[model samples]
Target: MYKAHFGLREQPFGITPDTSFFFACPSYQEALNTLLIAVRNGEGFIKITGEVGVGKTLLCRKFMTTLGDEFVTAYIPNPFLEPRALMFALADELEVSLEKDVDQHQLLKSINHRLLVLARAGKRVVLCLDEAQAMPLDTLEALRLLTNLETEKRKLLQIVMFGQPELNHKLQQEAIRQLNQRITFHYHLGPLNKDDMEFYVSHRLSIAGYTGGRLFGSSAIQAMYASSGGVPRLVNILSHKALMLAYGEGKHEITARHVRAAARDTGAARNKIWFLGWLAAAALITVGTSIGWAYFK
Candidate 1:
């Protein structure tokens, strides 16, 4: 809605995991680097964890796009299936044809054969799973067994898991201890810091074709940082809302007042702004009382 007023080619703050809007903040870049290195080394299992809205899915998509022709990539966006069902999903992702009413044994066999064929063709198979925290315990073990089909030189299949922090806790369980131990390369993605957050906003705006001078005021950025706690998703939500508010007022520059109003409307940011506001009011009252007491003395 505000794109025309802001001169944006597209919506800058959309929540979709669009790789084009992927801001290469420090944590995201480091996590992607770790994934690339681990996969290139033929690591069996790699884990990337982050808080909700920390851009794990975006990073996963970007990683897949970064792979060369020598790499075969399979993406499974949902991992909450049973062992047999999960195998079926993997087979589908690998484009392995399956007969009607095929048993688990045949499913595994078909998958193994496809992997070997790809390996012989000098292609490294990489499987990426998003929202992996919901994967069943038995299904996780089945995934580990799939990795056992490696040749002498390297693993036949590499698996990358992107999930929230709960996935780490789930991996700690005894039921999936082996799978947990198999994760050779692990990276935790965190939210952007203040400087990175500012750059992130600018980067996204620039990618969306904004050539204006500082659309967001410094105080507005500070308000967003405090409200969003440097989280990119939250920042996007706040920024989008603030832009709307600014557009509604026919203003070019987004100010802290716009951000505060946006934060008030956002459920995740509303509490934080209210708390900060309370603190500010309390401090004002304390200062007023101290001055009155000093004057009376």
Candidate 2:
């Protein structure tokens, strides 16, 4: 609705994990590089943990896109199935055909054969599981056992897990200690800093076809950083709402007032009294400066 108003071709702050909107901040870039290196090295098990809305899914998608034709990738976005179902899903992703009468052992054999074929063909096979923290304990163990299918030189199928912080806790369980020991690489995604947040917002907006100069002023950006705590998803939500507020007011640039209004409306402004007080102070200073400039001129 506000695209035309803001001269943007599309919504800049959608919550979807769009790789095109990815901002390669220092932390995110490092995480990507680590994943690439770990996967390329045939690391048997890799884990990336991040808080909710910290761009974990985006990073995961970016990794998949970058791997491209170099690797055969199976992405399991939801891994909450039972052990057998999980294996079936992986088999389906790998294009391992199984008849309706096929049982779990038959499915595993098919998958293992496919992995060995891919390995012999000099192709790296990667299984990326998202939301892995929700996976049942037995399912996780089943996955670890699958990693045992390896050649003398390297593991046949590399596994990459992206999940919330709870995934780490789950891995610490005594029953899953074997899987934990196999994790050759691990990274914890942190929130973006204030500067990164500013760049991230501007980058997404520019990609969405915003050619005009800064639409969100410094104060608004600061407010956004505070409100969102530098979390990408929260930043998207607040920035989108702020843009809508600005468009509704027929304003070309988003001011602190618009940000505050959006924050209040979204119930994200934690320090409401402080934010309103600053707004009042800024308004007074603007009015006073305007009067003095007019009188002097």
Candidate 3:
């Protein structure tokens, strides 16, 4: 709705994990590198954990796209299935055809055979599971069993799990110790820093065809960082709302007022009392600076 007003080709702050809008912040890049290196080395189990809306899924998608022909990847976006169902899902992803009446043993055999065949062909197999925290204990064990299918030289199948922080708690359970011990590489994705947030906002705007002058002022960006705690998804939500508020008032540039309004509307604006105190201090400093300048002149 504010695209035309802002001279942007499209909405700049959409919540979707569109790779085109991906901002390669330092933390994100490190996570990506960790995942890539782990996968390339054929690590048996790699785990990536992050807070909600911290771009784990986006990183997972980007990782998948970056894998070349040397590797075959299977992604399970939802891993809440039972052990048997989970095996069957992996089988489906690998295109291992099985009879309708096949049991768990038959399914495991089929999957193992496919993994061995791929291994023999010099292609590495990686299974990426998202939302792995919701997976049942038995299902997790089943996944661990899959990793056991290995040749004498190396593992036949590797697994990369991307999930929320709760996934760590799940892995810490006594029943899942075996799987936990198998994870050789792990990374915890964190929120962006102040610099990264600024770059991220500008990058998104630039990608959306913004050619106008600066839209968000320094104070506004600081306000956003304070309100969003440097989380990309929260930044997107606040920035989009701030733009809409600016457009609604027929303004060209976003100000602290717009950011405050956006933050208030989104309920992400914490420390209101402290914010007011800071505003007062800033106003006093501005007045003092003006007086000192006038006196010197």
Candidate 4:
């Protein structure tokens, strides 16, 4: 709604995982580098975990885009399915044609054949599964078995799992201990810190065609950091809302009041500000009561 008013060609604070607006903060950059190195080493399994709305999905997409032509990628956005169904999803991603009512044996055979073909063609196959924590135990085991297809040199397929921190706990389960052990490289994505938060907002705004000076005031950025805890998703939600509020009042630059108002309008961002406000109020009340008692005494 405020795109034109803000001189932005597009909305800057969109929640969608657009690589163009990606901010290469230290944490995200390191995570991406870890993935590149692991995949290049022909690691069988790699894992990346982060909190909710910490930009895991965006990182996954950015990683795929950076691969060279020698890499063949299959992406499973949702892996919450049975073993056979998950296999079918992989087969579909790899363009492996299958007949109706294919049995488990034939399905596995088809996937193995596809992997072998890709290997022979001088291409490496990488399967990226997003939200992998929700994957069924049997499905995860099936994933481990799929990596067994290899030549004398290296494995025919590589797997990259991106999920929330619960995926780490899930991997620790005895049922999946073997898979966990196979994870040769792992990286945990963290939210941006205070310094990174400032650059992150500017980065997105610039990417969205904001050619002017700082759109978010210093106090506004502080309020955003306070409400978002430096989480990218929450920052985006608050920034977008703050922009709308500013535009509503025909204001050009966003202020702390705009950010706080936006945070109050958002469910996730609202909690942090409310707790901080409550703490501040309680502190003031305690100081006032103590001073009053001292004077009376």
lDDT of every predicted structure (CA atoms): 0.92, 0.92, 0.91, 0.93
Residues 177-282 of candidate 3 have per-residue lDDT tens digits of 9999999999999999898899999999999999988889999999999888888899999999999999999999999889888888775464665688899999
TM-score of each: 0.91, 0.89, 0.88, 0.92
> Model 3, 297: alpha-carbon shift in Å?
66
True-structure lDDT of candidate 2? 0.92
Candidate 1 residue-wise lDDT, 65-156, digit = tens: 99999999999999999989888988998899999999978989999999999999999999999999999888889989999999989999
Cα RMSD of all models vs. native, in order, equals 5.6, 10.5, 9.5, 4.5
Stretches > 4 Å off in candidate 2: 267-297
49: Cα error in model 2, Å: 0.6
Predicted candidate 4 versus true structure: per-residue lDDT over 196-286, tens digit per residue:
9999999999999999987888999899898899999999999988998999999999999999999889998556668879999999999
Candidate 1 off by > 4 Å: 271-297
Candidate 2 residue lDDT tens string, 1-297: 999988999999999999999899999999999999999888999999999999999999999999957699999999999999999899989999888989878889999999989887889999999999999999999999999998889989999999999999999999999999999999999999999999999999999999998898999999888778899988998999888888888989988788777777775465766788899999999999999999999
What's the lDDT for residue 111 in model 4?
Answer: 89
Which candidate, 1 or 3, has the higher lDDT? 1
By lDDT rank, best first, the candidates go 4, 1, 2, 3
Query: Candidate 4: where are CA atoms >4 Å away?
Result: 272-297
